[model samples]
Target chain A: MIKLQNIEKVYRTDTIETLALNGINLHVAKGEFLSIMGPSGCGKSTLLNIMGLLDEPSKGELHIDGHTVTRLSDKELAGFRNKRLGFIFQSYHLINDLNVLDNVELPLLYRKVNAKERRRLAAAALEKVGLSNRLQHFPSQLSGGQKQRVAIARAIVGEPEIILADEPTGNLDSAMGNEVMDILIQLNQHDKTTIVMVTHDEQMARKTHRLVRLFDGSQVQ
Target chain B: MLKNYFKIAIAVLKRRKFFTFISLFGISFTLATLLVLTAFLDRIVNHEYPDAKRKQSLYISGIEERGERARSNSGLSISYIKRYVLPMKLPGAIAFSSRSNGTNTYFHGKKIGIDYKFVNSVFWDILEFDFLEGKPFTVQQEKNLEKVAVISQDLRDNYFGKDVPAVGQYLEANNEKYRVTGVVRNVPASTYMLSSDMYIPYTLTKDDMNTPSYFGEYAAILLAKKTSDIPAIKKEYEDIVRRVPHTQKRFLKTTSLADSYLDAYIRGGSQESKQKVWVYTALGIFISLIVFLPIVNLVNINVTRIMERSSEIGVRKAFGATRKALVYQFIVENIILTLIGGLVGLVLAQLVMIILNNADLIKNLHLSLNFTVLFIGLLTCLVFGFLSGVYPAWRMSRFPIVKALKA
Candidate 1:
């Protein structure tokens, strides 16, 4: 479960201040698959980043799993994020230098998992994504669809409680996008994983259990 | 995890070949220069040679005489040593020598230059020389003004065939043919006083003793019975000097070898100026100059490296890595980089010494990477690596995660 109240995000320059998120409030229950839809420059990605604990809110409080996360130090927040939340960016963001297996194993490495277990779990995650055969293939060697699958495998490798996806299939073809949406739906329904996704695609938003649409940094519909 | 770091480091370096080359170029070149310099300094300061007992000897290199307005500084004269220095009962052996110089000798229709030094017969008694062919000339031979000499192995190889004996052969030294009585191992260079190709008895050539003066071209060395007695000998000489009855009507004094070397650099004549401080400061500056540029350049390179690697760091931080983990990783990568560079620099340093010796760049500068030089060279590598690594590591670690991902 996640909660945000009176969240505000402002971008500042030498002589100008622009509110990216204004007086926003939202909450999601456990096992819920929520999609946030917005036009360009609507602060959806910023909200996701704040929920992922990667960015700070200008003025607000965010609670995740009954813990006040906004007051946590960077170190504590990182640990909390590692154990409780996972992220999927629009571009996949899989390290080009690492093979698929190593990329999946990266998150567990920070968790101080032993090498043997890290490899075993990473392989299992890759198997779950139907790419066990591509463990040795680098991100550069993979297709757009395959890269997104690897990112999903990486996000779930540590078994985080909440998966925050920012445009998970923005670059994929419709077939590949449908395949990714199916996997996310299966995770929410079978694995009971809570998912929050930001997307511009109306069909993808309609497929989720709930839709939170934003316009000009505020919830409109 | 360390293996993983090194693996990534190698991959990253391989990925950016030109940047790696730049970093390696600076690191290797700087380390090589440091290696060569420390080796040279070791050769000058701590090498073992003909004067292997260097620690047990006291030297009177130069003497200064002052009168109302007249001032002269020179080596101790023969009569001056006899009246003022030789009477010291603290030393086990006493000897004096004229400064060494190079003289041209005719050999096989070629003018070959040879370095020759004049020393008393007691010089052989005070110093240790490894004889290769025959024994040093006797004190009786010196007393009889024998024209016998001791030659270095290198000189023997030039005059005679490598396998042939040069002892008892007449070698032309300064246009005079002196019979060689011994052939000793050539002294490795930088021993200064004991570094010479040939040694001839001073009494045989210039021992008239009646040559009377307070300041003449003569320097004395006193060998102590035990190394511990050196301080006593120095004190006894200084005590004798104070009462030597200065005929200059101005001032007279003597000094130790360390003081003599220090005074040569001092601008003022006043002995109370604490010239050692200036000497140490100059030394500090020279060392700093040698170290500063490489460190500064490496720091800049490290900054660039960290910037280029920021995305990886950002991703790691997003995963779960703390700032300490990131800093530790970067520093470890840097140390590994410089350590490899240090090894390359060491090999190149040896090559440089070989080239210098072969080209006669420093004339018998038989430099080798001694233990002290090696330790300091590696220590320099460590310090250079750490200094070059810390700033970038800290700076990169401080980057906000959201911004770092954007970078």
Candidate 2:
């Protein structure tokens, strides 16, 4: 579950100011799968980033899983992210130097999990995404779809309550995009995991439980 | 966690080949030059041969005689040593020796140069010399003005071929022939007063102290029964100087101080503590410059290297890596880089010392990487790693996650 009430985000320069998110109000209940649809420069990813605690809203209040995260210190925010939330970026932000297993083990590393346990959990997550055979493969060695699956595995590896994915299949072909979408839908349906996804594709948006569209930094529907 | 950091560090280093090469080259070259210099300084300050008893020995190097119209400061005279130092009950033994003087000789149409010193028989008893052949001349031999000499291994090899025995052979210097009584290992030239090509009987020299003068080209050593006895012996000598009447003084007062070997070198014929401080401070500054300049250059290089890893840092932050964890990881990576460079430096230092020893640029100058020098060199490398790694790691740790992700 996630909550943002009247959240505002602004980008500033010496000569100009621009609003990335304006007076946004949104919520996703427990076990709900929500997709945000927006055009280019519509602040969809910005909203997802704020919900993920990766960026601070210039003026807003955010509550996630019964805790107000806006007042948490940076250290606490990191700990919260490690324990309560997981993120899957559009670019498949798995560390290139780490193997597929190590990439999935990243959040668990911050939780002080033993290496053996981390490896076991990471392997299980990879199995869920049907990528158990690619545990030793690097990000560069994986195909676009395989990389996105690996990112999804990483997002679910920690068993966080909520997952925030920013255009998880944006760089994949339609076939690979469908493969990734199927994995997300199965996770939401089978594991009762809550997921917030940002996308521009209407077909993918239609598969979610609900869809919110944004225009010029404001929610239109 | 540390193991993971190590794995990532090594991977990142392998990923960027050019940056790693440049960093390693700078670190290894700087450390190699420093290790060599450290070896040279170690040899000068603490030699293991010839002057092995230096820690338990004290030397009265120079004498000063002041009068109304003139003041003369020179090396201790034989008369002054006979009257004041030899009578001291605290010292186990007292010996006198003169400064080295250069002399040349010809053997088999080849000209060979020698630096010789005039030493009393008791000199051999106080200093530990490793003899390869024969024995030192006795006190009776010195008293009888016998024509005998103790030559270094190098001099023996030069005067007589290595195949031939040197003990019973004759060596000619200053148009005088003396039978070779002993052949000892060559003392390194850095051990100022103890290094010479050959040693001859002091009685054979013509510096007769018939006149009661307190100055000549001679020095005296008072070897303590134990290292703990040195202060008492020095105090006794100072007491003698204070009590002795200034008879036949060119001016008014006579004074001299017995000092330890290193202290004497630092004093440079002066009793001023300021001179010692100045020398030590200069040495400190010299070592700092050697270590500091390289660290500054390395810090700049490390900053650039870490900046290129900004995206990795951001990804780590997003994955729950704390600032402390990231900084620690970067520093660990840097330490591994420097430690690898340190190993390479040690090898380089040994090779350079071999080349220098073979070059024979300075007479009897043999430099080796003793344990102390090697330990200090390693410590310097660790310090270099910490100092160079800190600023870049701090900057990277403070990097804004959003901006770094964009990068």
Candidate 3:
């Protein structure tokens, strides 16, 4: 579960000020499959980043799993993110140097899991995503859909309570996007993993249990 | 954890060949300059003095005041030697008078002459000369007569053939037949007094003390009881000489062996004496500056590279890498580079020394890998690595996960 009360995020230059998020209030309950639908530059990504504890709010109270994390130090925030949340990006962001297995095991490495256990867990996660045979292949060797699947596998490998995906299907074709959506739906239904995905596709947003729209840095019903 | 970091570092270095070459070359050049200069200094200061207790040796010279200007000479007259040097009760004190003219020639049956020195009996006790055959001339032989001599191994081999005992055989020197009392190994050129092919005793037969013309012409080597006693011994010798009836008004002085050794090279010059220290200082400064340039360049390059990896740093930070961990990783990486460079530099230093040794640039010049040099090299590498890595590591570790990710 996550809560944001009157959150404000501002970007400033020498002579200009931009509001990435303005007076936003939102809540996500446990085990919910939620979709954040917004047009370009609607601050959907910024809000998602703030909710993921990757960015700081200029003014707000942010509570994650009943702990107010807005005042936590950077080190504390990183620990919380590693232990409690997973992120899947639109570009996948798989390290080019590492193979699929290592990319999937990245999150758990920060958790100080030994190599054998980490490999075992990462292999199991990849198997769940039907990528067990491609463990040694690099991201450049994988297809767009396979890369996205690997990213999803990385996200779920750590067994975090919440998964944040920003445009997870933005780089894939329709069939590949449908496959990725099916995986998310299955995770939400069978594993009860709370996933908050940001997407611009209306058809894709219609499949989630709930949807929140954003316009001009503000959330709308 | 450290092993994994090392594996990653080595892999990265191997993968990026150009960067690795640049870093390695820079570090190796810096380290090579340092090592070569340090080796040179070691050769100078540590060749024969590292374990030598000969610091106790002192040189006795007489300063005579002639009018307004005073002239100091390291040679003492026979009278001065008899009065001051022989009566001294200093515990390990031995005095020897020597005079060197042109390089003399010696003939066995008819082979040409060799360089030689006419010295006294105390020469054997004062200098470290290994005898190849027979014993040194006795005190009685030196004090009573002048028939005995000492020859070098070179003279023996050239005149009497190798492996033959030149001792007890007559050698012609200065148109006189002198019987060889001993054969000594050639003195190393690095010594204060170079080795000679022959040594003849100063018999003091003709009562030359009364002759003021040759008062301060001969060279004297005074071996003191201890290095600490040199000043007192020199003062005593000076006081004793000045108290003599005829030489009372004259100022007599004594010099240390080091000063005499230096004066041997630079005669008629007191100003040039300071140039020795200046030369050593300049050498030290030049080597230090040369080493510093590459270190500075490396630091700048590393900082820029680390800046380019800000996003990777952010990812590591988000994965729970502490600021300490990040700093440690970078510092370790630098140390690894420097250590490898130092080893390469050591090899380079040996190659240089080998070439110089073959060329005979420095007689007996050797490359010694002592613990001190190794310690100094490692410590220098550690300091350089830590100093160069600190600011970049700090900057990299402070990246905001959000801003870095967005970028």
lDDT of 3 by residue, B1-407 (tens): 56545755675577677777888888777776676667665544555431133455654433333323565444556756666567876636555545444445545446465666667777777775678898788888987886888887877887788879888999776667789998887553344243466777777334476655325545556666667877776676656655554433454432322233334323322223355577658767887688677778878877776766666565666555667778888888888877887788778766776787687654334556566666666677777677667777777778777666655
Clashes by residue pair, model 3? B105-B113, B105-B114, B106-B113, B106-B114
**lDDT, residue B87, candidate 3:** 82
**What lDDT score goes with residue B232 in model 1?**
76
Candidate 2 or 1, higher lDDT: 2
For model 2, residues B294-354, the per-residue Cα lDDT tens digits are 8888899899888887878887888788888888888888898899999999999999999
Report the Cα lDDT for residue A51, model 1: 90
The ten-residue window of minimal lDDT in model 3 chain B covers: B264-273
Give the top-scoring candidate (TM-score): 1
Winner of 1 and 3 under DockQ: 1
Lowest lDDT block of 10, candidate 2 chain B: B266-275
- Compute each candidate's TM-score over C-alphas: 0.92, 0.91, 0.76
Model 3 ranges with Cα > 4 A deviation: B49-51, B54-91, B94-284
RMSD of 2: 3.1
Q: Give the higher-lDDT candidate: 2 or 3.
A: 2
By TM-score: ranked, best first: 1, 2, 3
lDDT of 3 by residue, A49-118 (tens): 8888878888898999899999987678778888888888888877665679877887777777898998
Candidate 1 lDDT, B67-153, residue by residue in tens: 557666666677787787788898888887766778988789877779888888898887788899898888898889889899888
Instruction: Estimate candidate 2's alpha-carbon lDDT, on a 0 to 1 scale.
Output: 0.87
